[model samples]
Target: MSVVSTDAIDKWLLNRKWAPRDLSAPPAGSDLAPVPGDPGMPLLGHSLEMLRLGVRYGLKRYETHGPVSWVRAFGITIVAAAGPEAAQVVLANKDKAYSQQGWTYFIGPFFNRGLMLLDFDEHLYHRRLMQQAFTTDRLRGYLDRIGDVARRGLAGWRPGERFTVYPALKRLTLDIATDVFMAADLPAADSERITRAFIDTVRAGTALIRLPVGRWGAGLRGRKVLEDYFRRSLPAKRASDSDDLFAALCHARTDEGEMFSDDDVVNHMIFLMMAAHDTSTITTSAVAYYLGKHPEWQEKVRAESLALGESPPDMAALDRLGTLDLVIKESLRLVAPVPSLVRKTVRDTDLLGHYVPANTLVSVTPWVNHLVPEYWPDPRRFDPERFAEGRREDKVHRMAWMPFGGGVHKCIGMHFGMYEVKYLVHELVRRFEWSVPSDYTVRWDPTALPIPTDDLPVTLRAR
Candidate 1:
């Protein structure tokens, strides 16, 4: 069972006192239009409902209030926008009205100065330098490291009648991240500690209380631990000519000869490590669950894997798993590893004709958009063929299937992430056959990132 810390309780009490008063009020007689929807409750507002209902909460609000709606969550009134129009407006940020500071309320403290946290010109500069680390040659080298680490990690999993796949996959992805990003073999104890730190940092984003105690406190502590770890490891990385991401970042320079400062490297590493492992784990677990439920799809993907014969196929062979690619896209649609992207309005903006004030938090619910019937036919069904050439449902909108997000601030490691997940799934299918009960349903714990409440139990057999 998950433990709630005392600091969390204290933080909750403090949050109630700190709750905003105009949560249910409209954006005050604007010439444009007011966004619809109630704040839901006093102090707590729609926060608990959102945490409990997850994607359903957003969908219901969208249906009731149209594309643009307002709800009080996390102690403030946030404009929740659904469907492709909202996604395009917010993600594209063509008006320069949205700022990445929306994440500041949640992850800014833990992941300060990371690329995603920057806006405008600063973001472009950092992104350009970081691009050097993800060039084709660099990605190929990372793929080699991912293959080796995934094989080693999978070798430790013992198949049983009932096995919880999520935790195992989480550890495997973290191991892969360590190998590819840091190029260091962490001892078992260190790996466990680092994994815990990453968990805390991520979970802290959704903490009910803003106080620096309990789960929130752990998140703060985790940030320091990561800072220390990266700082201590920096000198060695700076001196080495290693091909790993850490070394690349250390030596990364722009055509203008600009390079990241020591502080920048540590901050970016903490953020990148969390981003690299956490999203991959979520995507892999979702793929495993769907494959277990659909045996035909499983067999089809497995046959592709078996034909390769290589335990960890090379980049060219990995590309040839066409069926697996479809399954990955469908799985991402089904569970969307990073469900929603957050932004804040830097200046007053008009969204779908609704006047949104400056400093308002905005939530772009891509997960909700992924489920809208208008864009996706029979939205809940697990049909990878929707991604196939003939249907191409995702083509309905440029932002329709945004599991990796969209626009300039989209995930930098997206290609690397996809490669890592594909390799792990390929290896797993080749070595094991798994299933969940036909009637089984996964209840995701809606933290900052969604994870299965029961850790995604399944029956496994070694082939």
Candidate 2:
């Protein structure tokens, strides 16, 4: 059984003094209800509580304030929009009111002007150009190349009693991202340095104290390292015809022949690397943990993988692994790697009955929405069958199981990310039998994306 921490801290959040509604008043004769909720623990608000409690914190807010509420955290007030109905509104963005400005509150400095941070026409235009890189022929080439990297990446693992899974997978995914996205094959020393830089920047997203200290400071420095490296490397990437994403971006164009600027190429490369590496690492680790805890599912998935000949399964083969697909889906719902589909409204909007004003930071809370009992059965259980054809609880609502987010800004690399996870996990189950102690539960750190604070140890045995 999984244990969720709800001790003194959880109780404190449940009973903390509430904050009054601060959403700006709607223009005259407007009927949009004011957004609501408690601001936990005074000035610090729900920040620490959120980092400590992940979904448990989100669940409590859903129960107390319903779909839309205000959360004071990271030194700002945010409209914490939750549930499928609210998700539909924000992701669809019918009025064009939501922009990447919400992400500006956090990762804008690090990932600024990358695809995810652009708004409306600019975003659509950039996306149209970027789409050239992910074409079907290009993805197949990426898969073939990534297979070699995955094999080499995992070749170092040996049977062990307490293998630290998260870090190892993190390193491997960074290698994959570097090879497939940037096409730069660096020496071990450089790869290690760049990997550390990525980690610092990712963790810095949640750093409330923005200064020349701690993770935030490291992130600032990391950004400089990347900027210098990319700027220096851009001339070569531009001159080449390499199949990697770096060259693809440098060469991609609309039919009208508009292409990325040098700065655009660098910005997109930095942000895409983070998006692919961190989220995949988080999702893969979650799947590994669940498969370890539930060996029956693991064995069934192994059988499916073994049934297909082991010589580097292609995209078609990866798609054919039914059991593994279910497991990945279940894992994604449980973890919600991206967690929040962030946005900030450009103007006033009614979010599921709440009055949210212009310039308000609003987010569609996939972390909380994925756990709502109305759309899921036994929201905390690890039942892959919830996604199996007959049950198909994900169909209960279009936004219910949206780990990849939705609408225009839905993850551009999602298909690629999914294939990458399936490929890695497929290879893993083929090579080893892994398990976790019956009592083991990941204590996730929500300081950034929800990652395991304990390193996620598991036992590994070669098959």
Candidate 3:
């Protein structure tokens, strides 16, 4: 039994008063429809089921109902659209017709107006300016920085030692992100505090009973503490430039020579911080898990890395690291970090010829698409060769490979993301050999971002 907070509900109710139409349910005869699920108390719909069971429950609904199913969660009706074609259409459409802001409103107070939440012109405007940080040169620079960080972090892993590696990857990525993006050296203790704060924030969002002083409340408070700290630090950062994403964004200028306002920088930084750390952590952990389970694949990747030989992989060599790339692609398909891509239809619109009434929430989950038999031959298998030359299974379906999302606001950091992941793999293969525990049964915590449920306990042996 998940609990809804009175204050949170009150806030929504009040916001609805000023924007009555936005709060209205989709007009009754919309072409799209919802799949029926186990009953809940009246007025709650299947909100509890959707939140508690996460993707699995929705998947069951899809299996029974069809590709598209509507169910209520968090006081709103979310239409989970499965299949590649439907996903392509919805993800391809941008702006007022589709609202990212509405879909992400649960964490709105925390994420605020970060690039991921911004829509239409605002999203484009900020994205264009921020794009400066992801240019080829910038990506190369980020790779150099991340490689160093990964080397340092992996140096601590002892051989023949058993330990949970998921949390360590999370910690590693945060430290890398803080250094690479924020130019901050956040101490281990402080970094741990921030990571725990984020865990509490996401946990608070899903807790069945969100009491006033509970997890969600603590998350909001944690956010304030974070915001105040960054707000004060921005001035100092502005005065001097550094080789980090924060300084880059702080001093970034568009063609028109406009710079980010202090508020914009702060909000965007918070969002980027979370996005970079969590997504990278999950994807990297997934790679480690797969490699540990499939030592053959690990050797394949190791050979690919070694062939690149002593010199750091240049763009050409990076592309030549086909096996390495395939491993990443396969791992991402198996365990998509951003499993569910969400949006809200702002206007009554037709998706895949099925009409979605105004204000209806739209979700396209990659977890299903990645495994759809039509796009993948043996969707459940962990085979990187499927992604090799002439076997591009992902190319079989347009939406088949969207771990970083698609369309206008598609992960601006995507290239940067791949670069970092590849670097982590390159370093891991070069330094250590790892394996999962014999009793390792894989599961995921899907509430916020998908992460290994058992914390990915694994055994490490130095190479």
Local distance difference test scores for all models: 0.88, 0.87, 0.76
Clashing pairs in 2: none
lDDT, candidate 1, residue 131? 89
TM-score for model 2? 0.96
> Measured by TM-score, how close is model 3 to the native structure?
0.88
Q: Candidate 2, residues 1-463: lDDT per residue as tens digits?
A: 9676667656876556665555566678888777776555667877887776768877788887788888878888788878999889899888888888898878877787889999888999999999999998999989987898889978889779999999999988988988898887889898888988888888888887988798789998888888888889999999998999999999998888889999999999999998999999999999999999999999999999999985788889988999999999999999999888779888888888678888878878888888999888789899999889999899999999999889898899998999989999988998999999998888877778888888899999999
* Model 1, CA-based lDDT: 0.88
Tens digit per residue, CA lDDT, model 3, 383-409: 898887787778887788788888886
Evaluated against the true structure, the overall lDDT of model 3 is 0.76
Clashes of 3: 4
Report model 1's TM-score to 2 decimal places: 0.94
User: 2 or 3: which has the higher lDDT?
Assistant: 2
* Highest TM-score scorer: 2
If ranked by lDDT, best first, what sequence of candidates would result? 1, 2, 3
- Report the C-alpha displacement of residue 90, candidate 3, in angstroms: 1.4
Best by lDDT: 1
Worst 10 residues of 3 by lDDT: 14-23
For each candidate, give its TM-score against the true structure. Answer: 0.94, 0.96, 0.88
